[model samples]
Target: MGRSTLRFRRPAVTTRRLIRGLLAFAILAALGWNSVLLAAGNSMQGAKKEEGGFEGEAPTAILIEATSGAVLFEKNADELRAPSSMMKLMTAEVVFHAIKQGDIKLTDEYHVSENAWRRGGAPSGTSTMFAAIHSKVPVDDLLHGAIIQSGNDACIVLAEAMAGNERAFAEMMTKRAREIGLTRSTFANSNGLPDPGNKMTVRELAMLARHIIQTYPEFYKLFGEKEFTWNKIRQPNRNPLLNSLEGADGLKTGYTKEGGYGMVGSAVQNGVRLIVAVNGLEDPEDRANEAKKMLEWGFRNFEVRTVFAENETIGYAKVFGGNTGSVALASHEPVKVMVQKNGNDKLIARVVYNGPVRAPFEAGQKVGVVKVWRGANVAVETPVYAMDSVDRGSTLRRAFDGVTELAIALFRAGVAKL
Candidate 1:
């Protein structure tokens, strides 16, 4: 055997220490993970490991029923966090509204200003549609770019075109967001570039997703498109569910150095739709996996049961000064709830209202709430409206009823003291 100058080279001791330190941090973080409470649990309670329910890695998440607006699962859903590319959904919604209002046309063309091109276009160190400066791309093409491709460049271009500048466009986005009921969210830019001012809660993001799907069904299909080609370059949609999951259709994904990975995903299975939003994930795979798990959990673990038919009386509320002693309450629409598979019939319901409601209320007046409790947690709350109109009672009757209500209150208080 020839004496070969073959020797094994070992990694530097410092490098080895750094790798070990990183691995250790990951393990400790997993072990120390502070999970939020599930249904009926104390807010400060520590994580209780359970199966067949949502116990995902994302620090914050929410799953909502698209039809009934019933929250299936939530973990820190109201905590404000960076929205990342998810903000583009709002940007697209603004454009969609403008087109719908005839303020802009799908065929209308917008100039790709140098500011948009240099900062967010292909030249910028971010996702871009590769839109050329001074090019006039149609509103429709840019919509696809911003949504399907998640191109920041397309967002900036459309923003400037719509509002003469990105700052003003962001103002419009914020205003429009509030108009659409996203009160806890704020938009600093059209494409959701890393800005401290851009913040949204997982709950509000789900609300916005549902709004887009319901309000703009015609344009919402753009989100499901797999790919878009512009400036001779093609890019696939960043939304992960559209391809991997069967009913996954449209939505957006987001990531930044500071915000980590986030997603707003929706899917429809057997006429039942679910919207899921997640944030604060360190890995993109984790975001995708968590989103899929939540949507599936929502569809699998819960089912919608109509508790009250439209115009069917759910309960009654006392009327102190009305022509009648009480008024029947009913749901204007079919009141439904998402409950555990065998648990639908076990829901405990109660009509909650202040008073004896006042007299002279209309038949359709919303007077009370029908709250359905599942275990210790409230599963759903349907607004119960007055089923029939009631005029004011006569003077003698009103005085008598008022006195009687007062007597009842005093009696209840006396009994409690015993």
Candidate 2:
């Protein structure tokens, strides 16, 4: 496989001329397998402050733009740690998905088992919605209890109601998580109680939060509710951001001796939404403050910039055994990135695909992805598709392409030996 990288310094303003220049640069740069670095200019002087300097006390954290899914800043974002009750987000997602699929209804009632009552109810000495044993509860109330009250009993009841047991429900949670693009998250139980099997990364947590917000707009409102009342017991929402930050709407908070303190929070400012996930803090107050600070920092510093307009050719992908040597690549949606407004950030954009691809593909077929990096983190990545279809080449052309691939493979094998 081969890779092509185009490195350039991001300018203060992005214009049509800059994009055209980058396209011409990509055409020439794609001819070589190695990376090409183009210096547009040196860093601007007299900048008031450097970019990406905001630091938080959380050991694992990530902040991202909600609409574009652009990473603004991250620290140990991929390191898997106990997610605590933040994993309840996954629990809520599972229930939400089932409801969306029409497999269940909000009015459906579940019988609370003795296990749920004894382990997660008032006797458990943990966050509980004070559910009564042997009593039937509606799914609507359970959702409110789980999201707003952080009620372990509510999650357990929902899990049992859906999958017959918490273990099976957790398997469903992990499977559903994968289906929604959360790759590294796993669940042991519904309420994110202490368990060796529950693990998640801050980055994936942020991604999950974004997915929930986008996928279930109606159900997501439950996250922002300040308080929930069930069975005559009313409890306030655990997520402090809802009360502390302006424009803060919904999300969840978690804590345990093992996972420390963690929360997934989202807030909107001036019509721009930002999501933040922080874990492994020493104090609950620190967790709330750190999440709030990160969201504020992201909104204050980053601005979205379009990299490529919709249907505009992003680059090219080499084709094997095709009438044409390469196919033009473009994204269906406009590719956008969030960057520090005043920083002189050097951006590296690359088109990555396993190629030369075997041909006979249709137009709009996915060919590769365009990844843009700001500083050390990937600011944004989007799928690039073929702009036009390519037919199979003549027999002579196929033979030549086969020979070329063989020679290239041998050269790579030799390089590996070195």
Candidate 3:
């Protein structure tokens, strides 16, 4: 979101008037001084926004609050591109769910097939942990290779172990992606290797990262592991931020001739966490620096403001033909907003709903939305629910109220004409 600066100007007076109206000019200037101060403050705030909200060099990028899912910045984030190895997040997710459901165990071992060996093995000249042919690898070691080492062979082996083959496992990945609310992503393979159909938006990648972090906390630590060893060969994690940026932790990186360099990185500083996704960069250092910049911008420029506590009444909504005249409206979770810092624009919240809602509304029924605005941008929009149920009024009372409502409407219309 962007904002414009405000400027103030004083009225001009002629020489003839200045001699006769010195007192009046002084008074006018005194009155206008407050306006000047307000405009200057607005200008400073606008400058801060311009400087702090810079979108980095990545063609597609997004930064979000890990806990609240509030987007702090976005640039072409919804446009689809090849995800490369970034698709491994979903692959990890599938295995995480399978393990949680007792369908698989980390101790389970799978035989590395020749396909995985040749395509993703050492001879592939791509990233790998160099799993030997016909060797048995445990699910735990394979995950380390896939996440920390970015080993394509490890991904294929896990895919085969989970769904019998990479193609079938890719189908499961797509299905699970849809189930997890990734609408714009499609998986052509489990490893996110280059393919015509292997594409994902930056927003989708960030969302998938959030889901994995929140849903699979027990397994997410594997992504932060610095090195993993298999077959007496040790490989370092490809995620660049872990070494250079403080508080940088688990995540994965990707690169392909068709997809470009990209990374989905998450970090927590002082209990506030941010997740960033960046893609389509020519250089790995550029990708790392841009992702770090995006995350730091989010942490520095935006702050979380809790507007209302959970179940606390925000306001009352008028009711029509109900046992009561009104009902309290509130949010199920604490309403929080990611506000741009150093901005004089006050955050304004308004309850929106069809007036005089009909009776018989149950408790917790969704009535409307509490829309909070900052300048022209919507900071947050939270669902407002009825705090208490309201039953229908007596038939006689309902009839009388209906007529009264009509009379009020008619009178308001009549006043508008005046």
By TM-score, the best candidate is 2
lDDT of 3: 0.81
lDDT of each: 0.83, 0.85, 0.81
The reply for model 3, stretches above 4 Å from the true place, is: 1-49, 315-321, 344-383, 397-418
Error of 3 at 148 (Å): 0.5
Looking at model 3, report the run of 10 residues with the lowest lDDT sum: 34-43
Q: Could you give the candidate ranking by TM-score, starting with the highest?
A: 2, 1, 3
Q: What TM-score, over all chains together, does every model reach?
A: 0.80, 0.86, 0.79
Off by more than 4 A, model 1 = 1-51, 342-346, 352-356, 376-378, 401-418
Candidate 3 RMSD to the correct structure: 12.4
Superposition error at 139 for model 3 (Å): 1.8
Model 2, CA-based lDDT: 0.85
Writing each residue's lDDT as its tens digit, candidate 1 over 148-229 gives: 8888999999999999898899999999998998998988889989999899999999999999999999999999999999
* Residue 32 lDDT (model 3): 27
Q: Cα deviation in Å at residue 42, candidate 2?
A: 13
- Higher-scoring candidate on TM-score, 2 or 3: 2
Name the candidate, 1 or 2, with the larger lDDT value.
2
- Give the higher-lDDT candidate: 2 or 3: 2
For model 2, how does the per-residue alpha-carbon lDDT over 1-418 read when each residue is reduced to its tens digit? Answer: 1222222323423454465456545544544333222212312234444545687789999999998788887899999999999999999999999999999999999999999998899889999999999999999999999999999999999999899999999999999999999888889999989999999999999999999999999999999999988878878998898878999998989999999999999999988899999999999999998999899888887777776789977678888899988888888998777767776566666788878878888999998888877667667778989999999999988898888777566545644654
